[model samples]
Target: MDKPKVAADSPAQVELEEGKKYAYCTCGLSETQPFCDGKHMSTDFRPHVFTAEKTETCYFCRCKQTGDAPRCDGSHKKLQEPERKG
Candidate 1:
């Protein structure tokens, strides 16, 4: 499988509406951050479809490494830490 581009090192804060469906950019090639802009059509990646159960502010992952789709799971923090030098 091809690796996705890194959209951001952190999450994107977005306001979601209840009962609305959103397509998350798994390819990270979208001009729209954290959202699919149909840029993954040529790639092996597919957008993650999610429906909001309630209207609220949510954090979407831009790192493309989260086990949880579309949402931030603090996985980006692992990349933020400085590596220990031997």
Candidate 2:
């Protein structure tokens, strides 16, 4: 499979409702950021289905490199920082 684009190097803070199903964008091509907007139909990627267990704020992975699917695991921190030459 092709590598997903880096939508952002961070997580997206979103409010989730209990028992609500969410389709997380795995293609990183969704204009909706961390959520799926049916934009992955053209790609080999599929949206991850996540059901909220409780009503609360959660962080969703936008970088698409999280160890946990659809969740932010701070894996974006491992991405190499650009070198700065003085």
Name the candidate that leads on TM-score.
2
lDDT of 2 by residue, 1-86 (tens): 48887878888999999999999999888889899999888789999987899999989988888989888998888766641111
* Model 1 agreement with the true structure over 1-86: per-residue lDDT tens digits: 48887778889999999999999999988989889999999999999998999999999989887888888998777764442111
Question: Highest lDDT among the candidates is held by which one?
Answer: 1
- Model 2 scores what on Cα lDDT? 0.84
How many backbone clashes does every candidate have? 0, 0
In model 1, how large is the Cα lDDT of residue 24? 94
Model 2: clashing residue pairs? none
Deviation of model 1 at 61, angstroms: 0.2
For all predicted structures, in order, the TM-scores are 0.87, 0.87
Question: What's model 2's lDDT at 56?
Answer: 95
Q: Model-by-model lDDT, in order? A: 0.85, 0.84
